[model samples]
Each structure stands twice: as C-alpha cells, then as structure tokens.
Target: MTIKVLVVDDSALIRQLLGEIIRQSPDMQLVGVAQDAYVARDMVNQFAPDVITLDIEMPKVDGLTFLDRLMKARPTPVLMISTLTEAGAEATLRALELGAVDFIAKPKLDVAQGIAEYSQQILDKIRMAATSHVRRARRGESGPPANFVNSGTEKLIAIGASTGGTEAIKEVLRELPANSPAIVITQHMPPGFTTTYAKRLDSICAVSVSEAKDGERVLPGHAYIAPGNLHMHIDKYGADYRISLLDTERVSGHKPSVDVMFNSLAKCAGKNVLAIILTGMGKDGAIGMQAIKAAGGVTLAQDEQSCVVFGMPKEAIRLGAVDSILPLEEISRMALAELNRLGAGTRL
Candidate 1:
C-alpha cells in the first residue's frame, strides 16, 4: 500500500525539499504541503494522509499546540521536524509526549543540502510512522513508587530503546522508587538532545537522571543515560560499577547502541542485571539481550500491543532472549517484582 504524506513547515525551502523527497519515493505519495498549522489542518482533514511531517517552529498556531489539538480531535501518526538547538530539543521532546512518532533535526545551515543528505532518514521515519501505533495522551499519573529489599549484591538495570523510548523510559523511571538499583540507559538520540532528555526525566522521576559521563561511578537511585553519539557500557572497577563511554564505531547501526550497552552489562554484572528491550525500529538489542539471558541476567521485552513499534522487543523475543513479555504500563512493576524475587534468591 502506498503511504500518503503531508508536509507542514513554515519554510518554503523545507516544504519543497521534503515534498520532492516524498514525491520521489515510489511507495509514498505527497498528499499536500502546508506552510502553517491552519493549512496543515485543512490538508489533514482533506487528504487524510497516513503520515504528517510537522515543523515545531511555525507561525500562528505552533506545531505543539496544533499537535495537541490534532491528537485530541483526530489522532494521526506525526513525525516532527525540529532545530538541533537546546530549545528545539525540549520542544521536540514535548512533541513526542504529545504523540509524535519520531523526529528529524532541521539543519542550522544549508537547509536544502541538509534535507537532501537526510533524505534516506526522512523516508525511513515516514515509513515507520505510517505503520507505528499512534498512542494518545493518557494523562495518567505514575503508579506508586516501588520499595525493594536490599540483597547486598549490587544490582543494575540496563535499558535500551530507540523510536518511542523517551516516553517509555520516562514511564519506567517514574515508577521506580528512590532505592532502586543503579540504572543505565541507552536511548538512540542526537548529542544535544540527550542532555535535555536526561534533565526532563530528572525533573519528573523519583530517580535522579543525568547524561552519563565517562568513568563516573554508577550509583543507586540514579538513571544515567548514555550521551548521544557515544556507546555507554558498564565496567566493574574494584567493587564498584562505573560508566564507560566509548567513542567507537556504531553497533547495530546506532551509536549509543542498545546492543553494546546490554552486552557490557551482561559481561560485567552477570545475573544481577535486569535487561529490558523497549519499543524501537530495528534489531539492535536482540543479540545483546541473548547474551544477557545466557549470562543469567533477567530479560524483559515490551509486548506488541503496548509497543509503538515492536521491532527491538519482537526481535529479542524471537531470539528467545526474553523471560517475560509485558505491556508498557506493567513493565516497571514487573521488573521490581522480579528484582525482589532475585533478591530473595529465587530463579528468574
């Protein structure tokens, strides 16, 4: 089936660049091009495009306001186009919270050339959005914080995600108690955005969340996110675990790759680690999750019904790496329960 797409951007250059890109894709049809939210709204209703590429910094009705309104009125899969600045990162994160499927950063210079260079990525995101689950804003509060008994053995929670991970990570972190074990996360994101994402999570979650720095000791009650464009791994130093950032080649087609992080955790923490593969668009974490399982670490995958895109988790389950498949809302609680059982010396 051919995917229909609408381009909504204030810049005429972006409209033309993206329109051409879409028109050139045999599998995608450029339904309409809107210069602002008002025109985008009409085009949306008229064309009923399968995917909408929206810009956040538009005049009159901004993308966020329009997105919020659109999601409430008529939900559709939306991909965001944003600047690579700090403010743009914040707004893009909010757009995801409001229901955008994914985002691509607008280049600061040479817009036309940049968009052309990003053509393949733009096409991939558009295709992913067309098939992804468009989750509406739940407006739900985080469940009660989990309380866990200390097992003396240091525990680690290693999480990996891509496409819809910002919200998924938030959902897991918010549900963790202040005494939860050290958490290391690898979420595929750009350099400037990861810092903002960590800060945003810190503000709302019970656990202290921050961008992981090289050689920092991993501590309980804190969630450390791998910096964008770097691979983060857990290394044991004496009796303590420390975060190690690698300026290495991309594994599984992503820097800060989930597979790298998961494999490291499996090797370093062994059975004491809880590995989770969340919603994403590729098979990045599957082999590493298998390593985790082989090392006796517990593994969990988000089920298809709850995943925005069930790619990574599905791949892990296919490899027989996951011990349990659970919904997004139930993962935190289940992880805590499993941790308790592990602490009590029960087999996972």
Candidate 2:
C-alpha cells in the first residue's frame, strides 16, 4: 500500500517541489496539498492522510501553533520542514515538543539545487513519519516529567533511540529527578543538533546534562549525550565507569549507535546496568539489548502505545531481548524502581 501524505506550506514553489518529490516515490503518494494550516486542517479532516510534511513558517496560522493544536485534537504523524537558521532550529525544536515525529532542514541556497540535495532526506523522513505512533495531547496536562534523584549503587542509566527519538527522549528524561543516576544516551542526530539538544535537555532536566567527552567520569546526577559523528561507550576502571568517545566508522548505519553503547555496557557494567530503548525508526538497538539481557542485565523497551515510532522497541521485543515493555511515562520510574530493587538484592 502506498503511504498517503499531505503537504502543507505557504510557498507555492516549496509545495510544487515537494509534490514532485512525493510523486516520484513509488511507495508514497501525495494525497493533497494545502497553502496554510487552516487549509491543511480541512485537508486532514477530508483526506485523513497517514503522514504530513509541515512547513514551520506559514502566513495565517504558523506551523508550530497549528501542530500543537492538531496534536491536541487529532494526533497524527507530522514531519516538519525547517530552515537552517537559528530561529528555524528553535522552531523545529518547539515542533518536536508539540509532538512532531521528524524534520528535514530546508535549503539555504538555490531552490532547485537545494531540493536536489535534500530530496532523499525529505523522502526518508516522510517514510519514517508514516510509521510513527503519535498520540493526541491530553487536556490540561503539564509538560513532560521532571528529573528525580536515584539512591543506589547501580549509579547509571543508558538509553538509545533514533528517528522519532528527540521528543520521546525529552519526555523520558524530563521526568527524571535532580539527583538521578548518571545517564549515557546515544540518539541518532547530526553534529550541530546534538549539542543544542543536550543543552535544551539540561535546562529542563534537574540533572546536569551535557554532550559526552572522552574519558569523562560518569558521575551520578549527571547525563552525558553522545556527540554526533562519534560513538560513545562506557568503560570501567575499578569502581568508576567513564565515557569512551570513538571516531570509528558508523555501526548499524548510525554513527552514535545504540548498539555501540549497549555492547559497551554489557561488557563493562554487566549486572550493574539498566538499558532502555525508546521510539525510533529502525533496529539499531535490538541485538545490543539482547547482549545486555544475556549478560544478566535489565532491559526495557517503550511499548507501542507511547512510542512515536515502534520500530526499535518492536524489533527488540521480537528478538526476546526486552524484559518489559512500558509506556513513555512509566519507563523512567520503572528503571528507577528496578534499580532500587536490584540494589536491594533482587537479581535480574
């Protein structure tokens, strides 16, 4: 079945360019195109498209506000098209918070040349968005959870994700406590974005969050995000686990892959580790989670209901690598509770 899509942008040129791209893909079909969010809403109600490519800037109702309202009322997969400017990046991040599944950076130069360069990226994002598991926003609910402290010897939590991971990771990390376990995260993203993302998370999360640096000690109450274009792993020397940043080639088609981190944790931390796989577009972490499970470590995957995309976790579950499948809100709590239990003499 062809993936049905709706394109929403104010610029006629962009709409035409995107339409041509969508039409070229054998597995995808452009159900309709809208000039702005108001018209997009009507198209959404009529076409009920599987995916939507939304431009961040529009005339009447801007993409972010429309996306926010759309998610609150009728949640569906949304892929944002944003410029490379700082303002555009900020808007894109806000769209993620509003529940956008993925995004593509708009061209900065010649329209045709830019489209030619980014066409594959745009198509890939749309395909991924079509598979996302978006949820409608609940009325009067507060933003994602706050970080809390962890009191135990386990000391660390490691997470991995891709595709729809940005928003999903934010939702999970935000709930953690001020003194939470030292966390190592590997999210699939380009170089410039991960630093911004880490900083963004740090501001919202009570714990100290920063991009991982080589040989940095994994201290409790802090989180280290693997930098883009590098693989991050954990290494143990005596009682301390330190971050190891690698310039090695990409594994599983992702530079900062979940498999790299999970494998490292299995070898170094072993029984002392907790690995959680959240929403993503592919199977990067499945085998690594299996390795962790086999080494007497605890593993969890986000369940389909709360996942923006069920690809990674589903793949892990299929491999029998996951010990539990919890919703987004429950993952952090479950991790903490399991750590507390294991630290209290309950073995996996």
Candidate 3:
C-alpha cells in the first residue's frame, strides 16, 4: 500500500520540493499540500493522511500552536521540518515535546537543491513516523529524583537511545536524585539540537545538565549529553573520566552514535558502569551493551511494550546484553536501586 502524505509549508518552493520527493517515492503518495495551518487542517480532515510533514514557521498559525492543538485534539503522526536558528532551536524542541515524531532541519539556502539533497532522509523519517507510536504528552514530575545522596565512588552511567528517546530519556532522568551518578547520554539528534535538549532537561530536572564538553571530568549529579552531529566517547585518566568528541564517520548509520558511547564506557569504566539501552530504531548499542555485561557492568533494557520501535533494546536482549528488562516507569528507580546495591557491595 502506498503511504499517504500531506505536505504543509508556507513556502511554495518547499511544498513543491516535498511534493516532488513524495511523488518520486514508489512507497509513498502525496495526498495534498497546504500553505498554512488553516488549509492544512482542512487537508488533514479531507485526506486523512498517514503522515504529515509540518513546517515550523508558517504564516496564519505557527506550527507549534497548531501541533499542540492537533496532538491534543486529533493526534496524527507529524515529521517536523524546521530551521535550527538559535530561537528556532527552542521552538523545535517544544514541537518535539508537543508530539512530533522526528525532524529534518531545513537548509538555510538553496531551498530546492537542499531538499533534494536530503530527499532520502525526508522519505525515511516519513516512513518511520507513519509506523511510529505517536505519544501524547503526559507531564512528568518536577524537581530531584526520588532516592537521594552523593556517593563519591567516581561512578559513571552511560545511556544510548534514538527515535522515541527524547521523552524516554526525560522520563528516566526525571527520576534521578540530586546526587545521582554522573551520566553521559547519546540521543540521536540533529546538529544544534542537543544543546537545547540538554538545557530543557536541566531546567526541569534537579541535576545540572549540559552538552558535553571535551576534557571535562565526569562529575556526580551532572548529566552530560553528547553534542549532536559529533560522536562522544568516554576517556579515562587515572581515577578521572572525561569525554572526547569525534567527527569520525557515522557508526551504525548515526553520528554521535549510541554504540560509540557504550563501547567507550565498557572499555574505560568496565565494572564501574551502569548502562541502559533505551527506546530506539537500530542495533547500534547491542554489541556495546553486551561488552558492558561482559565487563561485569549491570545493564538495563527498556521492555518491548514501553519502546516506540523496540529495535535497539530488543537486539540487545537477543544478544544477551541486558541484565534485566524493565518497563519505562521502573527504569530510573531500578537504576538507583541497582546503583545502591553496587555501591554498598550488596549482591545483585
């Protein structure tokens, strides 16, 4: 069956480009085009499209407001098309928070050629969005995570996720106490978006969260998010651990890949690590999580029902990389419990 798609963009050029891209795909069909949210709303009702490519900066009604209203009222799979300007970054993040499955950054110039250059990415995101579980926002807790206290063991926790990871990561982090072990995270995202994501989580969580800086020590209570578009790895210098960013070729088809971070954690921290492979779309972290398990580290994989795609964690489970599989809500609490067990020398 050809996947039905609706293009919503104020720019005629962008609409034309996206329409062309959708038409060229044998697996997808462009059902309609709308220049603004008003028309887009009508088209959505008329076409009942399987996926909608929604632009952030539209005339009449801004995409953020429309997205917020749409997700609450009707719920549809949306792939955000946005520019990552400084202000645009925050708006894009909010859009994701609202309900966008994923986004493709709009090129600042050569609109037609740029869209063409990224045609495959556009099509792929659309496909993924169509099959994805569109989750509505259920506001989580504010303030520090439940269990508390700073254990100065110089411990490190590494997390890797993609696809539905943004909210999944937030759910896990929101449960961490002020004195939680230092965390390093790699969430598949576009360039210029990770910084904003880190900031957003920081604002709500008790921990001091920031985009990882190379050579900075991995300190307790602070969470470091790998800067997007760059592969971030853990490095050990004696008892101290810091991050090293690499611009190397994409691993498992992602830059700032989960595999890169998890592998580095397994090699550097070994048994001192507590790692989790959360919701995502590929096998990037399976081998790396297995390495962690081999090195005596405790590993957690989000259970299948809780995952948006179930590809990454499912692969890890198949590979015997996971020590236990937990529902999404239990992960953070269980992580703290396991950390306490390890810190106190109690048997797992």
Clashes of each: 0, 9, 0
Task: Go through the candidates in order and give each one's C-alpha lDDT.
Answer: 0.91, 0.84, 0.86
Candidate whose lDDT is highest = 1
Q: What are the models' TM-scores?
A: 0.96, 0.87, 0.94
- How far residue 119's Cα lies from its native spot in candidate 1, in Å, is 0.6
- Evaluate residue 36 in candidate 3 and report its C-alpha lDDT on the 0 to 100 scale: 95
**Models, CA RMSD each:** 2.1, 3.4, 2.4
**Residues 56-154, candidate 2, lDDT per residue (tens digit)?**
889989998999988878888998888765577678877887888888876554645556658888888888888767755433533544433336435
| Clashes by residue pair, model 2 | 133-308, 145-174, 145-175, 146-175, 147-176, 147-177, 148-176, 148-177, 149-179
Best prediction by TM-score: 1
Which pairs clash in model 3? none
State the weakest 10-residue window (summed lDDT) of model 3.
339-348
- lDDT ranking from best to worst? 1, 3, 2
Indicate the residue-level lDDT of 138 in model 3. Answer: 72
